[model samples]
Target: RFGMLETVSEFAGEQLAAHGELEMVRGQHARYFLALGEAAAPHLRVAGQTAWMDRLEAEHPNLRAALAWLLAAREGEEAVRLAGALWWFWYIRGYPSEGQQWLSRTLASGGSSIARAAALVGAGWFALDQGDVTPGLAALEEAVALQRAAGDRQGIATALNWLGNAYVHERQYARAEQIHTEVLALRRQLDDQPGIAASLANLAGC
Candidate 1:
């Protein structure tokens, strides 16, 4: 099923390349192009990956492919799903500011609070990467609150992990430790191998 979708998407992309008028193909062509871009995203992380993403973004400049790839990777099942959600949140629009605005719009809605929380988490990370601490902390805190309200254990743990890093960035070791401790405990309970390794590494450094 997935492979068929990939092939269809790829074929559609090839067709789109032959004809610049996405409007000509309208519904199915446009949809297939988007699907193919996403389908190829995971494989794009290998050496030749950026070229495809670049091609997709250049052809579909109206879409937010670049920003989506920036926010999350297309690696592994869970990561891909998370990246897809991020892509949908921002990629329905354009780059950076507009993409963030679209993300904010979805977060503004009350439905899918968990998804909104995840969006905020992505925002927080983006802000921090840009060297803006205030907005980053604000977004991370909101994500933590939303995850808590939604009772999403996994989301809560992930938010806490990032929150701990934000705290550490501000030289608030105590607060960082508190959040990290919570993540560590949850990771232990879940027996998440990678999470455990990250938590242990953080603790060791602390």
Candidate 2:
């Protein structure tokens, strides 16, 4: 959690740029935080969730800096990856609006299909949370199509689960039920017990 004084940090940054190393250094920094975010992502969903959340919270500033650099550099794919990894953190930390903005900007910048699909899932959920149904539904639908084309079964199931929730939000119970049923089947096929439980719960709600 160490950090330099603002003046010192600025001076060092200037020196790096003077030496033609700023871009390289920034890239490394962004990649490091991206790895950190991805590593913490799984932990945030399961055991020791609070601990991982705290860890991310402590690194939040650095994570933002990394994302900002990535976006400024036009590293669309890397930016998407970083934002996607941090989406859950933003959601749980009550920063859905900010998360949505970052996701939207990164998506607009373009990325690989898989990366973009993952970011779309996050963006869609944020949009839905904010009651923007049309764009949210569109994002999730596109995510599903992209994930399906990429043969990412897990991604498809995840996106579908969110889509089902969106349908429920819109009071389209029949469509929600259909989507949840498909999610249940997919979870069973993947032997994802947690996902299976979620799908069942969603179906029950529908």
Candidate 3:
């Protein structure tokens, strides 16, 4: 159930107070953040520019609290999972540097999942943007490998799409061309019109 806007504001006030050490309820604020985290995930599932992303941008305060609570509570892989949900947001919105920081910390915690693929992809792009192509490619390769083993078609395509870009950064146009061509085939097979368009654009850059 979505919390009313007014309810979220009230809860935020309470949480801010708790953080200020003015007052702290045993479970109220914690529960509020927990719920907020769950609530935020549906908004992130699309992983690109969308109305949901606009909503996420609007909920920065509450979203930050939910994410902060997960990390501060030492929630293990849950923290990783929570942060990984923002991979698209980070990549699309140009927060790769911050994404790398959070994901590196998460990966250092020995987290693993389908979410792990998201972390790797985020780290890969962040590293690539920083011009660390080797580690970037390595992370992306692992991400693609994971998606393949999991038989996740969409995930594989997503990883490979970026992996192709990583290759471009390395001046490996042959590899990038091949990867994009492969992506094109997959997109055609999947009848992913948008993906096919994207693949065409990627290939055009090659």
Candidate 4:
């Protein structure tokens, strides 16, 4: 949890630029945090949730710095990876607005289909949370399509789950039920107990 004052950080940045090492150093920093985010992603969903959340929270500023550097460098794929990994943290920690902005930027920059799909899931959820239905639905639908194309069953299930939630939010009960039913079937095949329970709850709500 070490940090420098704003002025000190700015001064260090200037020095790095003067030394012509800024890009290299920033790239390294971004990659390091990218790995950290990816490692924490699963933990955030289940076991060690609180511990992982706290660790991520402590590194939030550094994570933002890494993402900013990646975006500034036009490293689209890395940016997408980092944003995709961290979106859940932003969502649960109540930073959906910021998360949406980062995801939007990464998406616009473009990346691999699978990575982009993951980012879309995050973007879609944030948009829905912010009450923007059209873009939200569009993003989620696109993500599901991409995941299907890639044969990423888990990814498809996750995207479908969110898509179902979006339909529920829009009060499209029948559509939501259909989507959740599909998700439930997928979860059962995967033997994901948590996902099965969630899908059942979603179906019940629908």
Candidate 5:
């Protein structure tokens, strides 16, 4: 019995070492994901949404993994960038809570204002979905202003969309309609059919 116990303890030590080695490998794997995420983010900008949904689904695990690693490495800016980039994917994939949590942490970790604004919009969207209306609306409003100052029309439109939705939830139908109307006009100017359809649908909801 003593010898068997000794053998078991030795096996446990081996398993522990294997786990440690796997973690070392995970760090390398995470770096690969970081590169892939950066490359993929730009493409999502022109998403037909469904096609990118499948792509983002496949990469979802790696996205989470990369987020964990970057945050752990104190690369908050990079983490913010990646998380902000995936906000749309996370929403479409029904992983808004995960997206919200990632953005919140990265934003708090202190990145560039642009990144922070992006994260705020992401977080605001999920927060509104989760019934956190007031703060969510505030975040969305602030993000829209920030993005506007930076001349990021797309970003401003993104935050405005969220704010419009939040106003709908709050039963501020007139406000919601006005916001979505502006979004619709912006999308038309950008020749974004998908965005135009989205804004029109939201406007209809109001």
Candidate 6:
């Protein structure tokens, strides 16, 4: 029994070293890694976790930059990526005021339509959350138009889904239905089964 316990302990030690559940990460992996960090921190030793984060930062500057933005409540491409890592991140963290600063900067500097469209969408969502329908609708409208102009069908569809939700909130069922139907058609055309399911669920909820 003692020998078997020693063997098991040795194996567990190897597993911990080989797979920390805190691998070095960057780019899109940043958000997921941070999420895992948050989820697993409670179960990990504090000193070990700090060492892991330090190692992660050293290996992945982009991820570090993203995490710094979140920690500081700052906003820019780096911060936006962190927020957009998942919709839940945005909901949980909320848009930083610094985001508006960057948005204005991007617009003034003549950034690409895609960038502008994304900023506008972010603004629209922020406004919606604040109960300002006019600004929200206007921002989303611009985002949808820009997305179409940029030939970003997926982005356009996403904007359409939000716009449809806005319409439903305003009790404009007919308009919402039109937008939702259009989204469904586009999802089908794209052969996106998951998207179709989401759109269907959205429509059913409305």
Off by over 4 Å in 4: 5-15
**Could you give me the TM-score of model 2 versus the true structure?**
0.94
Q: Can you write out model 1's per-residue Cα lDDT over 20-64, one digit (the tens) per residue? A: 844344434334444654665445435675666565555553334
Question: For model 2, how does the per-residue alpha-carbon lDDT over 1-206 read when each residue is reduced to its tens digit?
Answer: 53689999999999999999999998898899999998988787787899999999999899998999999999999999889888999999988888888998888887899989879989988988888889999999999999899988898898898889889989999999999999999999999999998888899999
Q: Which candidate model has the greater TM-score, 5 or 6? A: 5
lDDT score for residue 124 of model 6: 72
> Between the candidate structures 4 and 5, which one is better when assessed by TM-score?
4
Give the higher-lDDT candidate: 4 or 5.
Answer: 4
Ranking by TM-score: 2, 4, 3, 5, 1, 6
Go through the candidates in order and give the C-alpha RMSD of each one to the true structure: 9.2, 1.4, 5.4, 1.9, 7.2, 12.6
Q: Which ten residues in a row have the lowest lDDT in candidate 1?
A: 70-79
TM-score, every prediction: 0.57, 0.94, 0.73, 0.91, 0.72, 0.56
Question: lDDT per model, in order?
Answer: 0.62, 0.90, 0.74, 0.91, 0.79, 0.61
**Best-performing candidate as measured by TM-score:** 2
Question: Which ten-residue region of model 2 has the weakest summed lDDT?
Answer: 38-47
Q: List model 4 lDDT by residue over 1-206, tens digit each.
A: 43789899899989999999988987888899999999998788887799999999999999999989888898999899889999999999988889999999989987899889889999998888888889999999999999999998899999899899999999999999999999999999999999999898899999
Task: Point out where model 2 deviates above 4 Å.
Answer: none
- Per-residue lDDT of model 3, residues 19-49, tens digit only: 8852344234545644554566556644554
* lDDT leaderboard ranking: 4, 2, 5, 3, 1, 6
For model 6, residues 122-150, the per-residue Cα lDDT tens digits are 66766677688898899889989988998
Root-mean-square deviation of Cα positions for candidate 2 versus the true structure, in angstroms: 1.4
Candidate 5 lDDT tens digits, 1-206: 01237688578657867778645655666667666666666666564756766766887776787788788878788888888788877887788777888888888777877887878887887888888887888889988888889987787787788888889988999999999998898888888888998898898999
